[model samples]
Target: MAGTGGVRPSHSPTLPSQLGATFPARPAAAEIVRDLPWDDTPLGPRERWDPVVTATVDLVLSSPMPMAFSFGDSFVLIYNDAYADLIGTLHPAAMGRPAAEAFGESWLSPGLGGVIEEVYRSGRPFLEPETQLTVVRADGARPEQAFFTRGHSIVSDRRGRAAGVLTVAAETTQVTRRLQNLGELTSRLAVALTVDDVARVVLGYALTSFDVDHCVFAVDDGNMFRSVRRIRGEMLDEADERLPPVWKRLPDNPQAPLVAAARSGRASFVADGEPLREVASDRHERRIRALAVLPLRTASLSGALSIGYRTEHNWLPAEQALLNAAAQQVAQAAERARRFEAQHGTAQLLQRSMLPEHLPELERFRIAARYDVGVDGNAAGGDFYDAFRLADGRLAMVLGDVAGHDVRAAAVMGQVRAALRALALTDADPPGVLAGLDRLVGSLGAESRNEEIFVTVVYGVLDPHDGTITLASAGHPPPVLRRAGQGGEAPTAELVKIPPGAPLGLGGRWQTGVVRLEPGDSILLFSDGVVERRGRALNDGLDALVAVAAGAPSGDPRNLCAIATAAVPGPTDDDVAVLAVERAVALSRSDTMLVAAEPTGPSRVRQWMGTRLREWSVPEQVIGSAILCTSELTTNALLHAGTPAQVHIDLNAERLLVSVADTGTRGSVIRAHTDAMSSRGRGLSLIEELSDSWGTDPSVRGSTVWFELLIRSTSDSPAS
Candidate 1:
């Protein structure tokens, strides 16, 4: 047969006669097979070879396609010139070795040896589109095992009985692995949430799928670059002292390969003997023969991806393109992480601002509050709580939750909370205040009308005189009341039995309930975040909270609040707010003063009120308002009632109460007095604005005009 175009093995004169003229002249693989020492193989010496085997070798050497013929039961391997290239550097040494000795267990794979056995048994040919094969490289490189698609056929003697197997195969490892790796890389990057996550994915795929010994991924921060190094599949600590200086130097360095790649926005290769100490550990640089640096650049983010090879290798266009595609994916993931970080930071700030700074302290009441943010990007939760004195001398406490944990929800919560506070001040009715809040939320604009804009609230008014709490629900969790047992009995905790109305902004009627809390009894109001879990039922969460709260000291509101919040189940993916109030027997009065019925009663009450307020260190603004309200009420008693006024002033732990009595009718009604110049009816209007609450009550002697001013914490900012 005529020889193919490539170099041919040299023909020796000692070659068998059958093959002497038939074999291609000077074929490279033929020389390797003919020169192989057959004494060491099952086939014995070349001269003692069977014609069947010798003919097969001649046929294989004449073929252009890579061919390997395994003859007899020992399956000795004799491959052609084309097959030597497929085996890499294992050629000459593997020429006449047994299949087991040359290819080892790799040749015995089900797809290869099983098919070869089938061909021999049937005396027929077996065709496989692709069969995997692994071969060691003569240079001993790690990526020696390659994959191939092959066909097997029986080689027969002149008698036509099958005696050996012939394989024709083509290597397809690089292209196949590239495709598989690309698919896996895409899938992993799709779910990556952080830059570190992207690095792990890229490094892991490269170590197992590409021709590299180590890899690194870095992110640029405008000022410098931060990086992570992974050798094979294991991650190296960033603080490891043995790492190369290049790993720590910023990517902006002019001489660094990674920086060069970033500057050029392309792939850069460091050839053999080039300085790679900048990019690898000292121990790594000793074995690193070449390096490939790829830049990962996006509009919002920039970084570098570098791979190191232990053996000198010229970068191929196909491999370079594959790496570039991977870099693009990593850049996209890094950009996403950056955006998430910015949004999360904004959420944190907004969430912190909406929470209360301190709780209001009262004479006979103990109050505690807490707010816990979720662990998600929308950390600014809609939960809120506030305790303040209303215009009717009652303590108002409210707990509410907006449906989401984002900026919009937070904004709505602020608006809704302010509206509730204002409404509670003017109207003492619990249900009426909730109804007004519902209307206010609906009026917040189109966005507030979204179904997701729902809000649940529990608003209550506590009367210190009788220890009665009037609560209204707007589709919120009911408040739990804990009653301390008398005579050393165990205390009991249970949810207040109240009608759960529709959530605010949903246009439904709200309902109110009143519960009398005895001395040492407490009430806990909370948002759903403190009780809700992913798989738990609403009732189950409520039960757990009740159990936790019941175990706490009945008189310690702060401890009970902490216990309830700490008992929330599972991950807190939403904001939580808890407000607890405990009622004591009576608030101790620090001082009291009375003015005898006389024409100078109003003047006398002013001096006493001013002195007591200043002594208590009340805010100057609050003291001025209290003094004015007391003077107006006392003057009305001595002038309109036509009788001497009896003025009384009392100060307690929570508030200062002032009362003026005169011999008169109870028909003095409060008028709007909208005109700025009107002076006659403005006294009551001034009292309405300055004091939290004021009203006229009939006494045995005459009518008493009483008002209360709240004593707030020094830390609390005055409400607008």
Candidate 2:
């Protein structure tokens, strides 16, 4: 088997026994290596003797790295004990087999089989960079990881022909995982912002990156460690049940290492039996075998971050470090959220204080008012109501709802309410008051039209003297009037329909309407909300109100107002304002004086007049008419050129008077029914009918027309 380079053929039967004995003999090696290239002559101990060949075989077999042997032109390879372990019981007797034949389909991966074949064909060393491969175990149930041999090569023959290939390799799973973890850590840290966000990220990363059963971060909020972030195999059911009651009772208990460590700005690690001792009575200890409590510290405060394990296991230093960083980041974020809530609370308080304290009193009127600013979790709303007396002894009242529900709206409400009071006191008409309010609102630089701010108002002036209420409505519901009477057996209620006017700032013609208030009458003024509820028509609400008012007990105006307000269901989403005015009862007629006078006449006539006055219930403070009429007639007959004369007197309920007359030369004095002049003829006539009533006797004087006047006194009337 020797080649042309003077190399003897080792595979031949004529080959020297000494050279054959130098190599460890595989059952087929003697025949297989017979065509080798190297000389087998004994060189010294350093050069290759039988001992050297034996040592080389020992070295390859005993090396810690996985080693394998491949014969010429074969896909299978024979592996030693170390290589067999890497293959995990796959082909336990894998010796003298081609690598592909040994692992079957697994060895068919690209580049692996090709490289091995090239090595055997060329009889040259071929280096395969660190390549990964999957090798099936003997059970064929799972695959084990292995790294392919780097730089596999073969021993060549004298003519550079293919012979056998050798490979060396090791596993690199642990190192690869470490690099991946580092990458994940960097990514998580980059996006962590707030405390909750950091806790969420850390817990999420631990669950996904480490493939743990569950990850939870219990944040110590001074008193208790609240489970803020939790990632688990199953959605957490009754997670709190997993926590020890003692931990909850003493959230900041100094004796508790987790809490103490966090509050003191220190990290505490508990594992296995140690955690059970501190939280022995805790029910959660049974489920959580290993626990690490890390203190999250910012400059001002410190809190605890806890990690739990369902199984007993030791936590690695890397895991602890990652958790500690995450906890610290979460602490800072918690502090920020707390500060924001505090500032917001302060703003809300200030806004609330700006609202009105109480409603004012108005004589002979009932007023109910409410201010609701519709601001939730924020500042106060901008709605207000006011009732006050004007300088003219009149009541001035106003209810206004601003456009917004924020602090800005509240401020604007205050300004608008104040302006309304000032303008109202100045006796400005309703439209004038609104115009002034608009001007003032417009002047508030920041609260100008750009803010789209406006207010709806109902302003009124009530004169108690005549029970007259002059009101100017600006985009407000017309005040309802419930006259004190029954619509049949039920009390009647009517929405006092009036001319509509534009709301403030809409800029239009505004007119005020006057309503005379009779005794026992009521006037209702309110914001739209009191009569308007969603899902219910406004008319329906009005009807309900009317029904309630009709059923309510009668009392003062205030009582009626209360009943009306209670009729509406809560909550009156917007502000509500009601003003009621009732006139006082009138004075009795007897309390007034009456004046009466009858013309002087005969005693008989005087007697008749007295009888009439007495029957009419007239007071005794007048001069009798009969005597006066008689004296006048006698004087006219004696003092002037006269013939016969006549006298008459009359009296009645409201007035009394008398008249005397004289006759002319004609047959009888003709009484004129429609003439302004006739001296002697009219003197008696003027006194006749103009007085109560008068007549003439035709004995000496002509006929005469006379009257009596009765005067009735004037006085105040009571409430009807």
Query: Which regions of candidate 1 fall more than 4 Å away from where they truly are?
Result: 1-47, 50-69, 72-163, 167-182, 203-214, 229-251, 278-289, 309-321, 343-353, 356-397, 403-408, 421-436, 442-453, 460-471, 479-502, 505-720
lDDT (10s digit) by residue, model 1, range 1-720: 000001112311111112112222334777777677778877789898778878878888999877888777767778887676555544466667666566566555444444555666777666555434344333333434455556677788777766688877656787778878888898988876555566667877778887578777777755677666667534334322211112233536767777777666878876676557664435865677778888988887777888888877777787778778878877787788677667765675576566555567677777867666675644677888989987667899999998886778899888888888788778868889888988877777455456557888999999988889988899999988988777778888999988889888778897788998898789999988888889888888899888877775434565566678877668867787889998864553445455543555666777887777676666787778888877766655544454456666555444556667676432122121111112223457677678765555432345566676766653532221
Q: Candidate 2 has what TM-score? A: 0.36
TM per candidate: 0.50, 0.36
**Top of the candidates by TM-score:** 1
lDDT of every model, 2 decimals: 0.68, 0.51
lDDT of 2 at 77: 43
**What range of 10 consecutive residues in model 1 has the weakest lDDT sum?**
1-10
